[model samples]
Target: MRSETTPARPLGLTFRLDEVPAEGRRFEGALTEQSLGADLPGMVGDLGYRPTGPARIAGNVYRSAKTELVVDGRVTVGVGFDCVRCLADRVLAVDIREDHVLVRRKARVVEEGEESQTIDDEALEEPDVETFSGEEIDLTDLFRQDLLLALPMNPSCDDVGADDCRDLVGERAPDEPQIDPRWAPLLEMKKKMT
Candidate 1:
């Protein structure tokens, strides 16, 4: 007699539903920068944040329903970017918590007399929901999106007193008179009135 078994998955952020146990499956792995492939580069380019090193992901996938899987995880990554103020290269370590629901796509069969229904606007706004047709659940995209969103919008070198930053400050010497040319006439009138 042959027993049914779940297919084995290589180490990474992908899991097959059949492999997940009734109690849930826990996974831990590190994804190198090279392993992330081309999509990562494009996403980094668009977001202006570059990955400085590999990312570590640890998570649990639970069978919430017969056709749904719930994924909860934490991601730790190092990101690099040019400082918005100083223009110096800055690196930041980011940690993000991810939670999502993956649902199996149901085949739609419309009868000749049956009318098709469209999804409502409220359904469109649900951020944690995703649909998959195959038995495999790939969490790579979800993890990447979470990491990108967790990055700071304006990264800074945090060295405002440095020489490079001082050059950009545009401060004049204490003895120098700082005045706008347009206000010269007003200054002259005030001096005459005094």
Candidate 2:
């Protein structure tokens, strides 16, 4: 093993700063759930979805400033989720065009107030701002985050009456209420008033 002074190597979906070309660099790659680490796969978060295909990222990474790299790209992935109406397995094709994703130094991001470094509820006042150390930039988490954001709040196979979702879910018979016989008269009277 190397000495304590030696810096650890960047792993997984990371790009060392030295790899960038003078003009710019075009990055094209796929991010899998495994490569993204423990954060992905199976039921996750409130959305309760998982990736069914690789997250494809194609973009141009240009060093706009010494402390910043400007990235423009799109992310496409197929996500598997249970249909809200029928609970059937369904896939959603997610496509997000990221006009700009910044890979800035940690200090630079903090100065701009785009994000907070701490995880405490009080401290998390803003959304994430992708930051990289001086040596390398890792786009793995960014890809995963974008994928999750693209998912719809209510996911289902039905769109415009597909699979009779409205008829099945919306028009179903209401459960019979088991009230005391003594309250039956009041309930009927209440129903009549409505």
Candidate 3:
């Protein structure tokens, strides 16, 4: 639910040019659930997960080019969701590794009648490329995006020692022929044939 068109606001996880050394830098931070803001609650509700605690992010940002940075990081968070089978709340610890290329946006001039520009094939193929046009790069959205994608689509507590799950013994009922009223005539015909 985060928007890229809106102006960037510092979430205290921003990395400015001055913070990055010529050789790059390693940064770490802990973002509490409250700091993640309202968008996160909506996202978590949609995913049927209840956040249990803060999320920790740690990573290294490398200066790939004068106006480009490569970020490699890990986000870890604890969440609680109902088991798909038993409907019992189950706690899950998720850790997601993120790698992204941040490119400084540059202004471009287009002439009249020129064809509209499109993303390059390379950029389309690589999903981690993002563009920023500012002195500071805010990683708040990136962390949220990664965490959402990393959530299990169908979380189930089926592991050993999970007592909340229902137990059903396999059994077979007696084989009995069940004929619908509409099919009774056909069954009679088949019996006559036999």
Candidate 4:
């Protein structure tokens, strides 16, 4: 009987950042027990099994006239992913400490010889890149992207198959011959000539 225990689920909280309107307002909370939705599931494709883990997200948000939301903080996340090489389910972790600025709508200003541009304005209209919901920001997509970014395109988990895998990538094995599809017509012509 194999019994596995996943980490405790964190709590979920939701609040509007804009609700507390201030030049420099700071909001912080702990995600103790939470559940990730089916859309942004776990590392494994299996829908029946849920990817459970503990995460701590702390950030300071400042709302400026020009900037709707400016968040700066570190999101520590630990997750489990399948090893590409051995196909073994392994525990992988990532810490994303990033600063993101979201503008709801750019303030229009009159300037000499300046055509009103909507560059930053466009980004403001869009959803929050780091955290979408006003209250609790789900770290599922962010966590998954970070895990894949940390992984190599082809990771070698063993030394025995390292050479073989490298050779396969370089295509230098003697047993393996490179076949050119363009020569099919030439081979047919040569057969008729013979």
Candidate 5:
């Protein structure tokens, strides 16, 4: 699905060094059904009016002279996984709190000899909060990450029964009996006596 770019979000955060607050603020938004679409990692198909809970996101942005914006937040999402027994649909909830650091590469005026360690511009452009651009950041990728990690490794919902998958792992067949040729005459004599 088409997603909104970093610049397309509401003008909420500028992430300037001077304008940044000493205490970080809280950011909130909804990860609507349309937002997830078919791109969701798990088999999160729309099963007739299934509404996922409103995901909550809270984080703090710390700004430094060397770095532009540093953000940390907790993200929680509700997931639905099918039950292993009885083929029932089970609801699983997962929470992921990720920390992010954003560096203002555009504003960097460091000398060639200055040896500073920080996340580069390309890294910051990624979706998750690991890093973000100083110009503008989008949280859509961060939301997607949490949901993907919460899904189950196996998709089957039914329990495996013993009868369905039982065989002594290393069983061998019994050897066949061998009859003596002399026994054929003895067997005929025994039958005549009877």
Candidate 6:
């Protein structure tokens, strides 16, 4: 399972920085989970989200002023995850359009007596802006960012109607309240006061 915080290396969704024409070009393809791995679903099983099908990607890349790459695209896929109510597997169909403003990464310059690294934000107000370095621009990265955003923080059968949610209707916890040993004194004090 892949950790949510660490990003896997590029899985071959790259385009040359100098190759994009001013007129812009369209790129489209279907990305299989095998290619994107845990990022798409099965690989991120630890995150409780998985892809049930291939992710379709279609987009346009254009080289703009300041040598920035702008991406406009759409992705459609099904995500499989355990429902919060019953632990039953459920699938959520996802289709979303995303636009990314990508800028080439500036080389970090460490000066004398510098205790921290401060970034220059050229497009600080632009939503969904990203940065890359070198001659290659990886679209796979864009796919990863967008898909991660699409996942619901809490998925339940009731949310998507994936199931009837009847499984938890009559379930009940043990009559005894669960308590932590460290909190016994505090809890006892409160009970005495009551």
In order of appearance, the predictions have TM-scores of: 0.66, 0.59, 0.67, 0.44, 0.50, 0.63
The segments of candidate 5 whose C-alpha lies over 4 angstroms from its true place after superposition are 1-19, 41-51, 84-86, 105-129, 155-194
lDDT of 3 by residue, 1-194 (tens): 76664533322468786567556577677667776443333332244567788889888787888878888888998877766555567777888888989877665555789875544434545556887766888887787767766654445675323765652432322223222344344335444544
lDDT of 5 at 121: 50
RMSD of every candidate to native, in Å, equals 14.7, 14.5, 16.0, 16.0, 23.1, 13.3
Q: Ranking by lDDT, best first?
A: 6, 3, 1, 2, 5, 4
Tens-digit lDDT string for candidate 5 (1-194) = 65963332222323345445555454556566665543342232223112266555655656654545666666666655443322245455557776766554454566888965445656555634355545466656655554544443332232221233222343322222122343345334433544
Q: Candidate 2 has which clashing residue pairs, if any?
A: none
The numbered model that scores best in lDDT is 6
Computed on alpha carbons, the lDDT of every model, listed in order, comes to 0.63, 0.57, 0.64, 0.42, 0.47, 0.65
The digit string of per-residue lDDT tens for model 2 on 15-51 reads 8776665456777777865653333332332345667
Q: Where does candidate 3 stray beyond 4 Å?
A: 1-12, 35-47, 111-125, 159-164, 167-194
Model 4, position 100: C-alpha lDDT score: 63
Candidate 5 matches the true fold with a TM-score of 0.50
Residue 30's lDDT in candidate 1: 64
Pairs that clash in candidate 4: 9-33, 10-32, 10-33, 10-34, 11-32, 11-33, 15-135, 103-124
- Residues 1-194, candidate 6: write the lDDT tens digits: 75574422222357687667776777776778775454543322234567676888887877786558888888888877766556677788888898888877676787899864533365444445787878888788678656655655456676576547656576632323333344345445444544
> Candidate 3: global Cα-lDDT?
0.64
Residue 124 Cα positional deviation in candidate 5, in Å, after optimal superposition:
8.1
* Model 6, TM vs. native: 0.63
Candidate 2 has an lDDT of 0.57
The CA lDDT at 145 in model 1 is 63
